[model samples]
Target: MRNPLNLKAPAAALAASLALLAACQSTETKQETTATTVPAETSKTDSAAGPKFLSQPLVKDIYTADPSAHVFDGKIYIYPSHDIETGMPENDKGDHFAMNDYHILSMDSVGGPVTDHGVALAVKDIPWAGRQLWAPDAAFKNGTYYLYFPVKDKQDVFRIGVATSKTPAGPFKAEATPIAGSFSIDPAVFTDTDGKSYMYFGGLWGGQLQRWQKGTYDANAPEKEPSGDVPALSARVGQLSADMKHFDGPVQDVKILDEAGKPLLASDTKRRFFEGSWMHKYNGKYYFSYSTGDTHLLVYAVGDKPTGPFTYKGVIMEPVQGWTTHHSIIEVKGKWYIFYHDTQLSGKTWLRNIKVTELKRKADGSIETIVP
Candidate 1:
């Protein structure tokens, strides 16, 4: 974790100042600061409160969930879905997964201010996307950055699409159509050591419950994500084109296994993948991580290749403090960090904000469970 530096005051000095403010400043000034403070702008600063709290909640100005982090040109860049208020008055019927756009945030070093590079893509720019634009992931290939996002079609079926830009923080333009053969949502893309890129996605437990039950992602499927939906919630991964705009190979349904190489039983409650699939390669070992159902914890499996015949591992993180937790893991300057979301600002589960914590792995490459 990046330690806070350059502050002129100590912890005691900050406490004394707050105490002095209480004694001398008008009550109105404090109320105004608290109410007017935007989360994105405020969270960038570290305080005398110390290290454990240093590199957390990367932005606070707006609700940013499903953080997708990447490193390019020696800077860490984040592509997170923008969460905002929605319903009919807020939504047609108060729908909750009502995200509309993406914002790119980047930092030169740890414990530094993350500058919002502005809107990278928006629903208004997608010709066929429904109003709800959900979790998104991005990749840098050749000289262009490709954004992979999940959006509901006009018919309400979930589909994944790509957007391209020459710069990392971009005014990314969406492709004319989504990648063919993509059916579910939550698209996460990973680029390997050999320059081969793969996309991982699917979360039937939350959206498409009935259609998922019907055993496919077709029209006339379930209207919303099924409650505690289990059964066949297998995630899919496929190699991407060199341009990163389309899938270039056969997409494979990830059939999770035990360390023994046997398929996970439906009864194995502890090792099922519910949603939020993130793939990264560490030390030649492929780590496939994802959030568990109910959205409070994340777990993973490992394999030797990019398209994994992965074996189930234990939990990576638990107690993320929100109804749902979406995350991404990236190694920044030799330090591994896991980025996820929780409702610290709005105090409402629907409005999750982003947070980051340094992640530790055992000598054998398994991650130690993180209780965030």
Candidate 2:
């Protein structure tokens, strides 16, 4: 049976689905002014004897994936997709990932207990959303917290949305509609050193990026990869308006090129951009990383500017035990960490759990590939 994108089931049916997801589910209570302790397990890795899992699932009660972690006010805040057990058969279109809401997670330090701030945002709360609340990101501006996410509108086209709250953990109120020109998934908002912010977004395959080849959405376009011989699709980057809600200008292509200055072709699945766009600055250079969806590897490229003609660097992570790999990198207290997910908790790709491990870089600033 095809899963309904809007999640507009009968009350009883919806309750049952929620019940199936209740194990690790957090409450839907009002937002709190102070952080509250939720049941979370600290890392089980022993430094003396290296373990196979760099770190255990930060969340076990409720499944979480595609972690977008950031350090704010001396604590780490994680914005992740809240996975659920939807029995719809898995497909390339990600039908089984029928998540309708999001839960924000936080911790004071690495290896410390995590806290799940329940139901920061939900489908029913957003006026324009249809379903499949995929991976999301968070940013702290002047004094408010902004949450950027991708959801299919009532028309079933993916578009980016924004919600806001005074606290990092939110019972957020969403804007009536999505960002005007935004179309596609995995919205990563990167604030540069000069205090300007840019949003990088796009995804291929079921992400419906191929439909936007002419820079506008074409619903009739086929949902398939481009010809292997052609240059692969590029992700997009646009400067955020001063309000942090809209785009200041039209988005430009973020091209990842080979060492020989050639654009990666669709046939080069191992290196071409797929879904999961992330940007972080290291040593004054912009590092753009993403998941090679079908290839299952997390790779990166580097450029001098935020909107880049980046040169492919190398793999950041080998394939994890999952069909898809999505991630984020952040520096905390002089050390860097990578937050990603796999199906270790449930052994099912759609129902995944997020994990974190320290990241190491060579003296020349190149990242050491993580063999998770």
Candidate 3:
């Protein structure tokens, strides 16, 4: 039996026939965060020997995946989803990826031990979300830290939600409803240098990118406006409200550009994004990084603005031992780092753990390939 969790197929597919017997089972709530009780074992530093964690899997207490990093309050905070083993029924005996909560890990300086700050958000708190908590991204607006995450709705389709807290390590309270018109997973928020905010969200098997249109998502109904390509394994982008709680304008399809600088429409599933959409702005350019699906390799492209017309660079990090590779890129105190997850620990693709490493770039503004 092929593993059903590898591609993060929409909850619609798994909720009915597969996940009920696997990770999405109702009994699995060991990781969910409650206002009075969060269930992760917190620790500071390396679990093995030396300070190996700074350059390796920093999250050792529990399984974590799809990391998103941010610099706030004089520290670097990483928001990652919690993965668990649900005794999946498959030939590979893979993980059900029963992730239902998130944790924020931080550090005061480079080479310092990463501190697991406990739970940031959880599926049980979201009024509209189901139990399938997945990849998440965080950002600060005004004075609040907003965590953008994805979960299956009552209908079993994936929907994005925004949760807020005053602190980075949060007991974040998800809004009473999801961001009006969002879908899919991995909601990446990019705040441009000009103070404008934008969000890029979606995933394979019907993820989408569109600004807040302020209405409930009707998967069976016609779109409020005709969209270019909102289905399949594609990424989308749009301006977001200052509060980071809503979409403000029309969202457009994210595209990789050719050498001649034109949008490559064929990028929907070829060489670009499979999932895990992350954006970093440096030297007046935008670096769009993603986990190339089916290949489990991390790749990136460059663009002039926050939303692309990005030009595909090359494969940044080669494939790892896992069947899926989801990640994020950030610079803390002038040092760049890539935060990703792998199955090297549990030796099961579904039971992923967080990994971090220094990201080096050449003089020409291109990144050197990483073997990790």
Candidate 4:
């Protein structure tokens, strides 16, 4: 297990700074913003966030979540789900997260001004998409940038799709149909050192991973998890073809194990696989980080190979002021940073804002958990 790093700034000083910022903003008609202070350590017992912020939003003009951040040609590009209010009520099936389009956010460096390059891809342009263009990831191969996303088809079933562009910020052109044998939500592409790329995808509950357990869609799959010590469901991974659009082989299970090399139990909500699978290589170790959905923690596991059998290590970040937690990790200029989202701007789960902060590693190689 990883050890927790306590980096606490004075609460009184932070409160005073927030008050000053709010008092200054009260004179203007703009939306209220928080002080640009680093995230401080908070009580783990209290999941709900207080007035202090871990980091400010990267973009405020539009709600964005499930950030998939990458560095291409020395700049940071974020592919995030464009969140919008549709007045739809919330449910276990996630009807309220009615995001229908995607926008690309770019910046030359961290803490720098970000540019939103308008709409990269929208539901209306994709002939096969039904609705809710969810979380996406991008990759560059053979001089072409490919956008991998999960969207429901006309049959109302979620399928992964691919779009291509010559440039990173794209008015991308999507293929006519979803990728063959793709299912569930949050498609993240990881290109390893040897140039082989793999797509890591899947999520439980509303993400519909539960329905696909039988290798076919079972709409009547039990919504509740298994009882006793039954092994929990895990995320899916597949090797990408040379074209980067289709899976080269069959989708395989990404087994997340415990210290004793046993599958995490279904009742282990605190450490089980939930959603938002991300892979990054650090010091020759493969780090598989993901959100713990209902538990609201961003945790990770370590493995030697691109495809795991990764062992659960520890939490990366605590629950933010939101119900869902999704993120990505990237190393920039010899420094590592994590990009994530929280409901700080709207206080509603569906309307979230993306943020970034530096990620530090301990001397023993375990990650230092951040409490946001």
The lDDT values for all models are 0.71, 0.85, 0.69, 0.83
Clashing pairs in 4: none
Best-matching candidate per TM-score: 2
lDDT of 3 at 290: 82
What does candidate 3's lDDT look like per residue over 1-372, in tens digits?
A: 113244333334234324333543343355444322222323333343422222345645566788888889888787888776666544321226557677777776555667766667777678898767888898898998888888888877678889889988887899999887677678899999889988887765333222123344445543222324443324778899777788897677787765676554423444546568889888998998887665567888898888877888877787665577777888877789888886544556676678777789999999988876
For candidate 3, give the lDDT of residue 37: 22
Tens digit per residue, CA lDDT, model 2, 1-372: 111222133454335435645644433233333345655555564233433466678876678999999998899999999887767887768878888888898999987878877778998889999999998999989799999999999999999999999989897889999999999999999999999999999998778888898878998888776866899997989999989999998998899999999999989989999989999999899999999888788999999999998999999999886687899999999999999997655556777789999999999999999988
Q: Could you list the CA RMSD of all candidates, in the order they appear?
A: 8.6, 6.0, 7.9, 7.2
**Rank order (by TM-score, best first):** 2, 4, 1, 3
lDDT of 1 by residue, 147-256 (tens): 88888888877788888999888888998888987867789998888788899988753344235444466565544443353443568899988778778977877878
TM-scores for candidates 1 onward, in order: 0.81, 0.90, 0.78, 0.87
TM-score of 1: 0.81
The C-alpha local distance difference test score for the whole of candidate 4 amounts to 0.83
Query: Once model 1 is optimally superposed onto the true structure by TM-score, how far is the C-alpha of residue 13 displaced, in angstroms?
Result: 24
lDDT string, candidate 4, 169-257, tens digits: 88789999999999999999999999999999998877888899899988899764554689988889999999998889899999999
What's the distance in Å from true for residue 302, model 2? 0.4
- Supply candidate 2's per-residue lDDT for 152: 94
Q: How much RMSD separates candidate 1 from the native structure?
A: 8.6
